[model samples]
Target: MNTLNSNPVHGATRLNDWGLIRASGEDAAKFLNSQLTQDFALLGLNEARLAGFCSAKGRLQATMIGWKASEQEILLALPAEVLPGLLKRLTMFVLRAKCKLSDASGEWQLWGLTGTDAEQWLGDAAPQTRWSLGQKGEATVIRLPESGAQARFLMVQAKEAADPALNPLSPSDWQWLALQSGLAWVRAATHEQFVPQMLNLELLGGVSFKKGCYPGQEVVARSQYRGTLKRRTFLYELEGQALPGQEIFHSEDPGQPAGLVADVASKDGRSLILAETKIAALASGSLHLGSIEGPLLQPRPLPYALTEPE
Candidate 1:
């Protein structure tokens, strides 16, 4: 981890790593609702959803923030590396649905705002509530839940428009804040590595248990009801860099990995990681980064409580 300077610019920045996917036509909402874990069919114009696109085996391919742009159009924000392939795959499934999926990355400029004045900077465009939407001029603003040491919000505007006046933050700095928030964003390195529950997606209101079937709906439901899931995501801090998909080792079982890194960011010479690990290992053994001889990890409390099976 690198020690960050006291400069205020670290608080906010333009987000270039994220891209957009646009779904258009009459069946946009219905198609997305069937494919993702969120209940998009009922999503109002003023609301947004955190959703996951999974594989048939229940592994997550992408985690996205989705919102309705109009009655016939929906926009999804996700990592750019996974967007192209995901859009292609989703297009293959629109056999009869009146929907079209396209990569609309070039159509929008995404910005991440954090710090005490994050809301005031957006003025009327700042969403008044979490998971809600607001409009300012041509920009669409969504207030992300309080993450890290400050408030955070995501602003999306047309590419042809002028950039907002907020101080620019480095992509790395933004990532650090996001990791500290305890919300995991799936990237290419860890694609299809874990199911929604392993990342605590359900606790974040990303999963809808009463919705109809999607790709991995059966496996997700089974894990929720049968008490069959033994692994879950947790926040940890260590003194070295921890990359996504890196193996986590336990001293008691050095021959095999105990878990994998889901998301990581460095700050003030320390690394923060969101890891999916076996619950038993968390209780009985000491966990290390990378390998058995790697740096030790200290557990940290998550921002939200985990939902236990009923």
Candidate 2:
């Protein structure tokens, strides 16, 4: 097991692994609403949406935390590794929609804030609801699901803006806290491998079924209404390291793969993994990383409950 250096409980960390995509034009919101899993047409300034961009087969290509920057512009924050391809594909669909998609990573800086550091940054104006947006001068603050009791937030601001006044939090600790929050953002390695529900996106308010049609709307809808969702993302603790797209094996059925790692983060010799696996495979509670003989995985309770499809 690799031991990670410990970090302070309250501080801010610049998220270098994330990037921004800007959609600007009169049809910006309309264009995004037609392509993404969430309803963008009604996206409000004070709210943020956790949305999925999917393929025609319903596999998620990218997940985004997006909000309206203005009436005709929306900003999407996603893993930097997937930005180039995702931006290119999004632009292709804009043909004559009056929407222009471009890489905006250079225009904005992203930061991950935790615990009291986030509270101190927003002062009395902190947003209380998850996915809610608040502003501190020029910075846009979005409240994310907490990591246990510690509050977590994503702050976005212009590159020229002043940095938040807080101690520095290490990147490893910030990542660990993100994994603990049970939200998995799609990375390049795991692209097109899961439907949004497989990662509990709907439970996290990342999917909007009533929003009408999108790229994979029919497939996503069928999965939700058919009551055939046998796979789900779950949290597990392991002694060593794991990576995205790594196969997870079920002890009883080691001959074949049972799941894939959606995201993982390690700290102080232990790692937390968010994996999507068949629900039945979890019955025996025997899972392993890498191979069947690899490190044993211990199931951990997610912060939120999974709701059954009606």
Candidate 3:
């Protein structure tokens, strides 16, 4: 394993926790369109989309950042731990669709770029908007929502391609920056636990209410228009360690779980956690990491607004 360590303000780090999936064939785009929350059929060459792969009950099985490499090929970036199982599950659905799904993690490299290093790597070709795509030689870069004022980016290139030479960044800082952006990729521990809305995925452009039928389109759509949603994901600062899939508890209702930890990144003694909980729980009582006596969770503002689109 290649570990890069350097200043947190500006550097590039190998994202070992992420995996790549490639979908190819004449029906690649169309087949993905029918299974994911994003409108893959209309995906553009210059844009990437945040999407959710859900179960029939509308729980997210996996979440991904995907883009079109070509009309016949689409690339998806997701948690490596969940890749094999997801790949197997998706392959089972491609019976006669003319699409081939395979694990591409070993054939490609993924990197996380932060601050000036991100800007320097792409220079004039850097993508400005979130989820936008840019190209610099053989590397494909996707702009991500900023963590505070520091810009963030994801770069993908062939496994044999030369690595970008810049300062090295520790994995912890890279993960912290990603968590600060309030975006969480579904991991194996979190599989089939949350609906898109519960993670505020729709708020982050991860769900398409207007798209055609998908695995759980009706459930997702109903959650959107049926009534006011009572649960949502929020950013929080915890003084103690926390991990994804851990149960969160409320002070008022200590016997039962108030929510689930969607993602967590710890550095030093503090941690940044993206947890989904009851919206009402935020309004009154306190939240804890495991039990009512577990680490206290302090609410933090999200980088993006949570208002539902009109």
Evaluated at residue 250, the lDDT of candidate 1 is 96
Q: Which has the higher TM-score value, candidate number 1 or candidate number 2?
A: 2
TM-score of each: 0.94, 0.96, 0.95
Candidate 2, poorest ten consecutive residues by summed lDDT: 1-10
Order of quality (TM-score): 2, 3, 1
| Per-candidate alpha-carbon RMSD to the true structure | 2.3, 2.2, 3.7
> Which pairs of residues have clashing backbones in candidate 1?
12-169, 13-169
Candidate 2 colliding pairs, count: 0
Instruction: Give the clashing pairs for model 3.
Output: none
Clashes of 3: 0
Report lDDT per candidate.
0.85, 0.90, 0.88
lDDT of 1 by residue, 1-310 (tens): 3232234433457778899999999999999999999998998999899999999999999999999999999999998988887888788788899999888899899988887667777777777777899888878888886664467888899999887776667777787777767789897889999999999988888899999999999999988999667889998889968889999999999999999999988865778899999888977779999898999988887778876777
Candidate 2 lDDT over 21-56, as tens digits, reads 999999999999999999999999899999999999
Task: State which candidate, 2 or 3, has the greater TM-score.
Answer: 2
Which candidate leads the pack in lDDT?
A: 2
* lDDT digits (tens) for residues 221-293 of candidate 3: 8888888888889988888688899999999999889999999888888888999998878878899999998
Candidate 3 residue-wise lDDT at 240:
67
- Model 3 CA deviation exceeding 4 Å by range: 1-8, 308-310
List residue ranges in candidate 2 displaced over 4 A: 1-8
